[model samples]
Target: MKELQHLNKYFRKYRFKLLVGIIITMVARIFQLVMPSYVKKSIEVVEGYIGNNILKSEAKEMLLEYILIIVGAALLSGFFTFLMRQTIINVSRYIEYDLKNEVFDHYQLLSLNFYKKNRTGDLMNRISEDVNQVRLYGGPAIMYGIQTLTLFVCLVPLMFIKAPVLALYALLPLPILSVLIYQISKIIHKRSTIVQEFLSTLSTFTQESFSGISVIKAYALEPKVNAELNNLALDGKSKSMDLAKVNAWFFPLMILLIGISNIFVIYIGGKQYIDGEIASIGIIAEFILYVNMLTWPVAVVGWVTSIVQRAEASQKRINQFLQEEPNIVSTVKEETPIKGKIEFKNVTFTYEDTNITALNNISFTVNKGQTVAILGKTGSGKSTILDLIARLYDIDSGEILIDDVPIKELNLQSLRQSIGAVPQDAFLFSDTIKNNIKFGKENSTDEEIIAVAKKAVVHENIMGFNKQYETVLGERGITLSGGQKQRVSIARALLKDPQIYLFDDCLSAVDTETEEEILNQLKKESKNKTTLIVSHRVSSAKNADKIIVLENGKLIQEGTHEELNSVEGYYKELYMHQLSEKEK
Candidate 1:
């Protein structure tokens, strides 16, 4: 219950529904308790008519009235029970909806670091599987369990009124029942945590295998993947079985205590009846009604205990995720309508849990409308620069600025809207080429999409498709070639008409001729926008306004291609090597 304290806001919203359900449940329980009394009354009426203690006509009328009353009570109970169930279900759905929405909203608010640190499949499980399980076992079970408790509490006093000694005897096994359930609940909580984690791991594997099915097929790793999946499935099965094994022992223990309580009631109440200390059979029948009412609440003790424990485990996992603070957060106040000028002021960044800095105290500035190219070997922090510019990561030592104002002082949405990025690995959804191109600018006209696609040298290819711009690509644009995907991504970024454009090795997948053509078009298109390109090919960087070379997390050289070609440095050696290889 303490673990679920985060749900107070949602609970408050549906308090009225819960209140109505509880009231209906109480009404149903009261009506249920009255049924046995009606039964006893009917029996009494029959006995009186037989003994001739009353006139036949009067007894017949009394019996008819009693029968009608009993039927009405039964109907009342059924109605209230139905209404309670309806209300509780409504409340459950509402809570589930709210909880799911909250989790999604939180996931969106998280930074890129969160995604890097957390698996997509695990996050999916947390938002989907974990939330649904909590709703299933947590919400309705708790509601009904509470109603059951209320029924017992209300009827217990009534039982004492009917036969005080018998009532005490009926309650004698309660302590043992509670202790057993308490211990069982602890086990359930511990086991449920392990089960939920295993489920998450299984979900991770399932999602990864499906997403990378192409890679698996290409590598001919079907048997290996299947074997791994089998292991995960077996683990999941064993955990679930263990949960069931613990759950199985609980109900029988409850039944044993309940059986003992019933026996005690029968023995003590029978003695009282024979001794003439008990009143009419109606009181005894009512006692029996109380005893029957006790069964469900006691039995539900097992179920409710399990539900509560499971919920606690789930809540802990959810809260643990929510507790994670984003590594990148704005440290300054923000104002919108920013100018597109970027500067890395002696910036350095080292990832957590790593000794090596990804980016050293590097400094560079890309003025508005300027085109800069970053030339680097693999893992030379080319993409890291773009990440810092987008504020995907914060610098450990220095700051980044846009238009002389710290980027952290600009609204995140505003800053991002001003910049458009096309990375090395282009991604697309299963949507029409037109829609994919118009992704950033939702209301972009077809002409605008065609124009950008043409600039990126992809319009001819799109028109070659059977459906042209309307053709829907497969998942992750699998139907398209790697170069086509890159072109589409470029077109998508181009359609944004942002003030700053970032091409992080965007031309790597395309042929050199196509890459040169796209770069020429980008040079023309970004005449008034700051453009930055990260490329391994010297041909791609040769025409840039300026080029920077990086090595081992440090800026080693900065110049035009001609200036770097004249120098004896890393860039010069790289160029000489590529030229020598081309000659061979």
Candidate 2:
């Protein structure tokens, strides 16, 4: 219960709904308590009519009256129970919806460092299963817990009034029952936590396997994966069964105590009545009914305790995730217009958990409307430079500037909106081709979409499709060929018409002829915008106004393509190799 203290804010948010539910629960319990007296009266009526102490006609009328009263009491209890369920249950659903939304929104704000440290399946568990666990505690656990306690409070006194000695006997074993449940609940809490974590592992395994199914099948690794999956499933089952075993023992223990209490009432109360201590059999009947009524509250102790402990475990996980502070955050909300100038001044950075420096002492500048290209071998830190400009990861030292203004001090959304980046991996959503192209600008016109597609040299391919611009893609755009996906990415970036463009091997999949044509089109279209291209191929950067060559983590050479080609260096080597390939 102490672990669930954070839920007070949610309860307060829907206090009116919670209050109405509680009031209805109280009314239902009161109506339930009122029902036993009718049972007692009905017994008395039977005894009275049998012993000839009342007229048969009057007894018949009284019996019917008592029956009607009992029905009315039952109806009230059912009505209020239904109303309470509607209010409290729906409140839990509403809170779940709000909580999931808030967590997902927070995920978008988190930095790449956080994602690198966490697993996708674990995060998914927090959003879906963990949220449901919290809802169960706030919903049925709270609602039924209140009802059980209230029922116990109202009916216990009535039991004592009917037979004090029997009431004491019936209550003697309750302390033991509570202790037993308390101990079992701790074990349940530990087991439930283990089960949830295992489930997360299973989800992650399935997600990764499906995403890389082609590789798995090519490598013939189905047997190995299946065995691992089976082991995980078995582990989850074992933990669940451990919790279930405790639950199995808990209910019978409650029933054993309740069964003993019932026996004590019949034996002791019967002796008291025979000895003339109890005046009528009706009093004994009412006492028996009260004990029966008390049974559920005692039994529910285990069930609600299980719910609370599960929620406590789940809440701790959720709160820890929510408390994480992002590595990158905007320092300003409003700023002057960007003029497309980008400068890196001796910037250095290393990825988390790795000692290798990805970039070191890097410094360069691209004036507005000028084109710059970064030439490097694999892992020579070409893409890292572009990532730094977008502020995806903060620099370890030094500063990046745009038009003499520090990039970090600029608003994140505004800074990103000023530059259009086409990454090495072409990613597309499962939506219509037009929608994917229009993602950068939601209000883009159809003509604008077509115009950009034509410039990117993908309009003819799209028009050849059955639905053209309305064609929906499969997951990760798997339905399209690699070159088609890259062209779509190019078209999406072209439509943005940003102040600057960052192309990271954007045409790797296309044919050399088509790639050249698209590059020419981009050069024509973005003549006035700052453009940076990062590519391993010398051909891609040959036409740039300036080329910077990198080796290891440092810039080794900087000049125009003609100047680099004239020199006997790595650039010349790459150019000679490509010239030989073209000759073939």
Q: Give lDDT tens digits, candidate 1, residues 272-317.
A: 8788887555556666666766888888878877887888888888
Could you estimate the TM-score for every candidate?
Answer: 0.93, 0.96
Per-residue lDDT for 312 in model 1? 80
Q: Which candidate is the best by lDDT?
A: 2
lDDT (tens digit, per residue) of candidate 2 on 281-335: 8877787777778788888888889888889888877888888999999999786
* Poorest 10 consecutive residues by lDDT, candidate 2: 1-10
Compare the candidates by TM-score and give the number of the best one: 2
Summed over model 2, clashes come to: 0
